[model samples]
Target: MILTREAITTAVEHGDIVIEPFAPERVSPNAYDWHLGDRIRVCEGDELDAAAATRVSEHVIPAEGMVLRPGRLYLGVTHERTHSERYAQMINGDRSLGALGIWVHVSAPLGHVGHAIRWTLEIRAAQPVKVYPLMPFGKIVFLSTAGATASYQHLGHKYTRTSGIDISRLYEELR
Candidate 1:
């Protein structure tokens, strides 16, 4: 079941959920609004190979903002570091940003249990859109799980415990 704002607050109080620099005002009815981190990475090559480690160039979003162009994949990070061993997480771009043609993620949105870190945002703009550091970017909703669950950390995932924007690690699985 999806957690409500009250449940989220209670979970945080009880240590079932954790959000660094938590703000009560940022909590919505069922999701928490998260901000954009200062750093972002853009793919360096025109041709990307799935079996090879993707090359990316990291850039710090300036104080004014950075413009994201169409037809380019930019990896961004959330400002908040969050974790929840007892619940699963999913992120989505807010409608306000969506209307401006900003997609916070391309495909991956599900967060595994025990995968504690700042989320890497797979960003793509339908048009040229300017984004600022620490700007309200997206919302993350938590869900309760039933039955037994395995920790993502124990699974040896390549994207575990990330601090910044992480490029595709699918190459590791292909090896």
Candidate 2:
């Protein structure tokens, strides 16, 4: 079952869900709004290979804002670091940002129960759009899990404890 806002609050209160730098205002009815971090890595190659791609240029979004052009992928990070001991976390694009044609997290949106990291956003724009650091661009919802589950750390996942925008680690698996 998906957790409600009250349940989320209760979980936080009971030390079940952890969101760093938590803000009361950022909590919605069922999810917590997350802000964009200052750093972004824009892919600079024409073709990308999941097992070989590594060419990217990092840019720090200025306070004024940075424009995201169409047909380009920008890997961004969330300002908040999150962890869930009991529930699986799912990150979704904020409706306000989506209305502006900004797509966050292209495919990988589900996180494991013990996933602890600052979310990496697979951002793309339908058109030209400007985004600022610390802007609320994503929302994370926690889902209840049943039975025994393994943590990403326990699994030795390459992207388990990332603190910033992490380039695809699929290449590591290929090794």
Candidate 3:
């Protein structure tokens, strides 16, 4: 089942969950809001190869903000690094951002029980929209697993310890 705000607090208190730079005010009734990081990476080529698409251009959002255009994928990172040793995590686009036609994640929003990393957002815009760094753009919800699960660390996941926008590692994993 999905965890409640109190449950989340308890999990953090018990060391089952961790949110670096955790802010009490960012926690909602069921999820916690996450802000956008300063850097963004956009793929440089028109054709993308799942296994070897390292051609990307990185940009930093300025004080005035950056414009996100449609038909392009922008990889963004969350300002907070989150991890849960006992619970699975899911990141979703904040409602306000969704209403503004901003999708913070695509299909890779789910995280394993032992996942410990800052989220790399699959950002896209439905239209031209200005976004600022440190903007609350995503919400993360924790879920309880039925039984004990293996840790992502021990599982050798490619995206386990990512610090910023991770380019696709599919090719390396497939080799």
What C-alpha RMSD separates each model from the true structure?
Answer: 1.0, 1.0, 1.1
lDDT of 3 by residue, 1-175 (tens): 8898999888988889999989878888999888999999987777888767578899999979999999998999999999988999999997799899998787898989899988898989999999999988888999999976899978988888888899888899777
Q: Global lDDT for candidate 3? A: 0.89
What is the lDDT, from 0 to 100, of the residue 24 in candidate 2? 78
For residues 1-175, what per-residue lDDT tens digits would candidate 1 score against the true structure?
9999999999999999999979999999999999999999998778889999878989999999999999998999999998988899998889989999998885999998887989999998999999999999989999999899988877888888688788888888899
Residues 1-175 of candidate 2: C-alpha lDDT, one tens digit per residue? 8899899999998989999989978888999989999989999888888888578999999999999999998999999989987899999898798899999996999999899999988999999999999988889999999898888778987888788888898887887
Candidate 1 total steric clashes: 0
Distance from true location, Cα of 175 in model 1, Å: 2.3
**What is the alpha-carbon lDDT of model 2 when measured against the actual structure?**
0.90
Residue 52 lDDT (model 1): 96
Alpha carbon deviation, residue 12, candidate 2 (Å): 0.9
TM-score of each: 0.97, 0.96, 0.96
Ranking by lDDT: 1, 2, 3
Local distance difference test, each candidate? 0.91, 0.90, 0.89
Q: lDDT of candidate 1 vs native?
A: 0.91
